[model samples]
Target: MAAILSGDRLRFLLGRFKDRLWVKPLVVCLLSIVAAFIAKLVDGTTLAQHVPEIAAESVETLLSIMAGSMLVIATFSVASMVSAYASAASTATPRSFTLVVGDDASQNALSTFVGAFIFSVVALVAVKNNYFEAAGLFILFVLTVCVFGMVIFTFVRWVDRIARLGRMGSTIEKVEKAATAALKRRRNAPTLRGVKLTSEPHGRTVVATSVGYVQHIDIAAIQAWAEENDVRVIVAALPGTFAAPGRALAYISNLSREQGLEQKQEDFDDTRVVRSFHIGPDRLFDDDPRFGLVVLSEIAGRALSPAVNDPGTAIGVIGTLLRLLVLWGEPAVEQDEQAPSYDRVEVPEISVRDMFDDAFTAIARDGAGMVEVAVRLQKALHALALVGDPALRAAAEYHGRLALKRAKAALAMEEDYTAVRDVAMFSETGSQRNY
Candidate 1:
């Protein structure tokens, strides 16, 4: 019953394309041309006195059939495009869109996927019905549906990752600078101390601290210090470069204290391997985990954008994580050991991994390290958190690294050969043992 309703919806969406301009005619014309060619190519050209009559009848029949099929295909093509637009819009979060989509991006990709599916399905159904007697036609229908769906999927990905051409001329510097500035600010924290501080982009203030203790100066003067003295480095993979937190954008080299006083923004046409989009489709973030650095920058970008500073810390974080997971593939992080005694106060009875787990049974049954091991992992985060201080700025970093390290260790443990270890492939998947 549910399947029927879904089909109806799909058909209805595809039907909408029939009324579109140029779709009906184009489809009918293409099909007509092909059908005419087939009519000409077939063995039965004419049948004597009966040949003329037979040829006339055959051409008329073929042309009619071709027109009908063309009409259906035209309608389907339009529907697929519409569905793709919707699907692309749907999956996309409301990014600063400035960074990826646009600030007001919508999640409408589902409709597009459905549209494409519906379009392809309609074409298949037409083939199944009209070409039931022709084996070649049946094969063609199946191939068409598969190819169309794959194309739609690829189109959606492209749209999601890169900006449309209309906005090609626009600059992608806001988030670009944000990532670098944020990273440099954190990496060169010691220098930022003497860097003068001022209320600039709102919520966050720019601090003009020195690379080291410097001569006292006015806030206005310090503002230009970074620029005049040339204090900053050109962070590779600039802001919006899809970097993990703690990922080195660029390294700073020898610079006089005066040069370190001011960070200047230099514009250069970089023709190197610069990725405009960070979809993480490829294993892009396999090494660096410094993407967390961009979330704050994204927030700052939104808070200061031309379209009402809509800070997107969560969006940036999720985007970074999703990209990281997809590019490098996520290890079973939840399986890692937690720090020792970090959460031991109330969970003395449980392992850190188990305590964190929703179900205690699963954790204990797994081959993760002892609860004591997880406790130590948790303790490591806590200790590092304290040392790092400024909980907001540093705690998350320490904790994130701790979590990743522990998860990685746990996965390694699972792979290790041991007496109690479980390493068997499941019969159904031919992949690995479920347990």
Candidate 2:
């Protein structure tokens, strides 16, 4: 069955039409006028003898011809012009609208009229001595213009949609990159200038070190020395961190400060420190079930829990841990098993951090129904910004985490109504849930 288009749907279809591109009816109108003129001249000279009565009264005949011909041409012209407007209105979107300067609409309208005049004049000239016969050709000219317009408009939409897809794809890729992070071993470390190795184990032993590397570097000497000395080091430079050649990382022992530097260094600039680390088999210190749990407990106790935070505190802490491990120059997990073995996918855009954000958001605000909160939580990205947009996103995510942050607080305080009011205010599902 052929589906019937509704008024609104039809309008939508028409709006995308290119008005200037479809000025066919106007062209036909101009040709028709030319054809009519030719017909009048031929009829006077050739058919004048046969149609004496019609030709005798020249002023009357001229007036009648003007009125009848004008009425027919004007009706067709109005239909053609109106159709252009209708097509444009249907397809144009609010977001796609860029207010063009100058007078495009008026100019297009004028051009349409000009095209019409050309078609009308040409048609009348072609059918000499027979104005009524020329009128049939005029109608055919109008049909041809409309058909051409429809074909052109149909192709334009497909081209536009393809262009839009390309644009949206690029934007999404950038967003994806900004979201996922690097947990990688370093070589030609770029962003991180060098590493600062502090106090090692008491027994003069060093385990393998980890870090990220952005560029290429000569590490034969560094590797040979570490192997012979029985020391393990890590270089944790990110993928984009710039590293210059011949810059050696500094190994500083007995580092004295307000807080003792025991384990590994942090993410910092390139010019300050120097050192390269080692890579070993990936393994955790212990199979402690309590690793994430302990962090969550601390968070809950300090009001820093992700359940009530925008960027959930728990997820942020985990992300930081991942980042630190990366900086330590460790080999990250494989992105895909089938992917080349040369590299591991440390933080794909859709990451564990993004996952945790969703989980925390669900726990913070119990709003969604008929959906698995945990499944949704797994979609969070691994990318994090400590001081800037990352922090803001984290905060928003925390607020989205659970429904009972304040309630938990109020319940702890023995205030029921205040908790109720708080929950009500923040009960709605957060926008970040989609993220």
Candidate 3:
């Protein structure tokens, strides 16, 4: 019962709810229903008694006009959003399509249109039935004006957002924002609020029963279970990992035969441990930095494709990746001095080396023939090497050499090859002269 209502579980559920396109629109529809009822209530109150009568003809006309126009507007907006999502999928990474579809501005705009339409339709029906009193009519008129104002404001913002919604630059910005958020969360809880897992598990390993990407982990649930069992739970997988039935999801340690069968049976619940983690078909940006990095790399790959041949977009993505890496390299902010949240739960820290590979490996391969991209990549690595730690710098140097080798093989011109090699050598040696 405690694990079921854990904060981690709640947050994971809430995050999933917010990603749906229908959630906001459905909420708006419910709110509209409530508002309609409130308007009727206000009509009977003394506060609305002083208001002048709104003619039946006038109320009918206003409601009819808004109802007709709002439906048309809502349909058009939905079509535009669909088109934008399709374009984003075709041009940028398909993984980014979810973010584009769930954009707050677009969702809010669509919700407003749907809500206004519902309000207008209900108002029209009530007015036609002569159900509204003079005060109710007056209240409805005021709300109509307010809805008009909101619709206009939302339309303006929607137009502006649609213009850049799925473009390369906008997509890069969204990925960077997501990556930064994931990095910050990891920085705070590098081991997922548990002890760091450093080696292979010698204890009983709990394998997954299904195959899917791990989306969210319920650390609170694990902590509670661990405390009850008096054992350390070492997580073998993190968010974005592909869990197979035979693969270890986590490992349990410090078990003994001293406890009776009933106690042992009650303590080790593999199903509960599996339930603590949410598995899904696709990865989410909330808890997975690797997904963001992979999406960014996808954008670079798409830009470097033969049909597109947009090196500039790839360069921009590289710069954004560097910014994300630099942020990840910085130490986490000071945390509270209270007892560690999940002392019995153990998780592994993210690898900077893996991060570097995710950010650059594919881009280097695809953009090898483009001298401009090669030189820029080399220069970027050199800059990163100056600021990054030993492991980070080592990864950067390794990629720098690989990129240079590919550049030499791809570039036919001696000058272009020399230019990229010189940059790569400087990056590798930190020397003034070329190798």
Candidate 4:
């Protein structure tokens, strides 16, 4: 529970930092102010003699110039990013705008520029006020030079990333990275280290109080609540699940009652469990790989639209999906040294079939007319079939056949039709089956 909470807290903090560019720059400004104070404390006898060449007036002029220029550059950087976000939303789907806006390289570049400006201004003021002795003044000059170097380096890198920030390829990579992380986490703890709730739950059903998608579940809180109530919690709705106001979010089963304790027949408390599950209007990427796949599909769908007519982009998306499926198809390790985090809490594993469908369905539907996309889809499915997981193989086979059928109906050219059907042979358990 501590581990889970700590990890969640760290992830939450990181999400906050990524969303806003000010936090890092704010910290940088504070540190620069502290550095000025620290410079006053350091002795300045020998270093002052050696570094006398750096006149205080020259240092102040340099700092002021850097402060002015960096501020202007930072403003231009923000405007350019806003433009990039708009272009990404217009060219690709708006779903990818969040990733583009929160891009680390661009954010760090802007933060560096802002931080440098703040550092220079504060250091300039300190120098003019004689807050720094000779050594401290020298130290400030050295740090200013270092800051200048960082600005140049960061600006160069930002230039490269800004160009591709909202482009189709970069968007695909961003979504893939996020989905891969989520999938890896799901693979590690498929059931959230709790028993699978297979049959109908026996205890009281805890209905959702609101209508939304389940964004996150506090497993530790649920376990603690279950322990206090002497019950087991069967999670009915995992993250990414849509919950109606009256739908069951979880089920509570009373465990062993104490020997001398009397069992109360009153209502079970559902507040804690309900509060533990966070629901929102849309799905989140942190705990939900399906959302990432959905966005990827949206990108492909836009590419296949008449205005875009970019089958190559769709093919590239299909390739990325194949990589994701391959990572997900790898066998899950069965051994776990530690006990399940929530001994009395149960959670259902995410459905592999659903993930596969979420990933490939729309792309297959939208790209059915293009022979390049159709062949690549079939080949990708056949490759997944080679992973030897029957369920995944079966899902792949189903989508493959469906995509081939769609191609058959949509493609007017016989050569294009033959090209797709030719690659539909799927090998399972040493036996080859043509879709």
Candidate 5:
């Protein structure tokens, strides 16, 4: 359990750090300062004399030019990134801003610019103070040339990426990728490596202490606690659940009832159990597969609005949702069928109906009047119904009927309504009717 908790915690912390804009740049800046001092190691050695005599004026001129140009470039990069973030929020959904901001290419470009600028400034200071011998100056010059080449390479790549970074297609692709990964993770571990909670357990309720979304649940920690206390824990609120002061986070039942009064409800540490659930102001995409689906639907909804009127994007999102949903219906690999790692912890599986609702409900409602969108949506749902999973087929059929009904009402032309109805053809028992 300790090993499990350590790996989980490490992954969580690394994910959090990767999302921050400053962490990479700060580390690069520190490395830049260190690199400036490292060249001084050969200051007093005979190697200093044997090395080529590079003029101090030439080095100074190069460093001065880099310092001035790099600062301006860094400022421009920051402005461009800010614009990209704003465009993603306005064009797509604001919830997608995190994924856009965490883009590796943008962050790496920014870090390189800042790091180069710092290196130039430090090198300039060292030159003016006469801190380096001949060897040190030569090494510094070589490092400066390498830095210049890296900057050029990074800037060119960043230019290409920034051009399409916040555009509709790019945004949809990003959201789809995130949603796909989350869906795959949840599909593999439906109960989070714990026993499935079939029904409500009779136990003492453990309520949350704060108001926020449940971002991460440390099942390993909870399992360890349950094992130590000889209790069985039923997780009431999964990730993405909105938690509040009075909301139940989990339930704890004494497993050692035969051992008598020593293991009673009063002895339970509610605080420890509550602490295992990390609450935050907003839901995260890492642990909450539903959040990603919700964001994708939001983008489609906005595109279908009168102000945007981009049905192509909505159609594209439907295709993306289809790919993600297919993953949900895939059978788990043999490794996943082994015994549960956290036997004492029981967690409820994600609802298939809820997943379909999050992925398609808004798009179905918003795009009902458009014949192109309506036809595409019905086709997508019809395709999902063909997947082998019974639960998936049922949910897909339910949503298909609902979307068909919505289109029939919103679309004025009888021909347009007929078009949607022809594609849907939903029937009970996962069978399709001939049009």
Candidate 6:
């Protein structure tokens, strides 16, 4: 069990659980109940005598106030969060709803309100039933005061966060942050700490059992299975790939063929191999960096739509994409100069061209007629072409030329066409030309 739930797999599961709305509130509620009972332990302690007695009426009044106000506040918070989720889905892309919903400030505030409400109700019930002595009552009073302070602090912070929670700029920023983190992880571990799959895999194919997007691959688990079975596993599908029952998830080749252990390949559990590839109805941003880029592009496309006609937002998204792409192009620091951690597992690297396509293809097509967006995009692409990474330069140049072609066809005015073409000259000649 420990081996199966270790490393990235554990982190992935925890990350998913953390995003749930009920998880934090449930934990906080449990803690609140525990705190209510813990004060009872001070009933026979000498420390209770040292603490001044808190008036029963005063404590009761405070708990009653908290119980009433916190319940109202929690309800208001839920309504506000639901509104924000709807706004994020409507204004931005629906794909970004998860990021908006999983906001830490919003979740923490809701948890605090719910927890405070539970604490007050529980304390009120205990007080009415004569469950606490003078010493226990004093402790409970102090805990109640602390809970009040926490509620106030959380409410203030949450107010500030909720103001901009569902705005387009905030949504885009959240997507960019997610994209940056995923890109950084991929950059550091290009093959996911596995041997690079440079050539076509030649072995027994392991097909997926489900049909959905590949959300994560447990490289450590696959490596363990490979070691135990004396075989080399080549992962065919990376995160974000669509998995189907007929699609090959991996290829297993017998490593001990010289020892006449080839027969063992027939006994390989394909179920175990399929389990390492997590399939979900939708792609996740945690392991699939391209999903972030795609979502960002979707937001830009929506902004550039005929009904929206918000070219400025599209231009802003281009800048955000540039920042992420530049981060991806940066030199990665190697943690170990030796062999990869999962030597028995081989996986393919994410293609830079695909990243560029995911990041800019839709924006270019949607904003083609808008000269402002077109010019800014060409300049952004030009900037990327000079980033010094050959793959980055090539992808940027290819996209730049493609966007220029789109602009030329869409722009009827000669001046608008000329303006975009001059900026795009950098992609063709490696330097911008003065018109």
- Name the top lDDT candidate: 6
Error of 4 at 219 (Å): 0.7
Summing lDDT over every window of 10 consecutive residues in candidate 2, give the lowest-scoring window: 93-102
Candidate 2 C-alpha lDDT tens digits along 271-310: 2123322211221111111122222323322233234332
The digit string of per-residue lDDT tens for model 6 on 109-198 reads 999999999999999999989899989999999999999999999999999999999999999999999999999999999999999998
Candidate rank order under lDDT: 6, 5, 3, 4, 2, 1
Give one digit per residue, the lDDT tens place, for model 4 in 287-365: 8878888888888899999998999998988888889888888977677687786788989887878988898889888
The most accurate candidate by TM-score is: 6
- Give Cα-based local distance difference scores for all models: 0.31, 0.32, 0.84, 0.81, 0.89, 0.91
For model 3, name the residue pairs that clash. Answer: none
Q: List the residue pairs that clash in candidate 5.
A: none
Summarize candidate 5's per-residue lDDT along 389-433 as a digit string, tens digits.
999888987999999889989999998887777777572322475
Once all C-alphas are superposed, what RMSD does model 4 give against the true structure?
A: 3.1
Which residue pairs clash in candidate 6? none
* Cα RMSD, each candidate: 21.3, 21.6, 2.6, 3.1, 2.2, 1.8
Judge candidate 3 against the unseen true structure and give its global Cα lDDT, from 0 to 1: 0.84
- How do the predictions measure up, each by TM-score? 0.23, 0.21, 0.94, 0.91, 0.95, 0.96
For model 4 the local lDDT of residue 168 reads: 70
Candidate 2 vs 5: which has more TM-score: 5
Off by over 4 Å in 5: 1-5, 258-262, 427-435
Give the 10-residue window scoring lowest on summed lDDT in candidate 3.
Answer: 426-435
Q: How accurate is candidate 6 locally (lDDT)?
A: 0.91
Residue 267 CA error for candidate 2 (Å)? 26
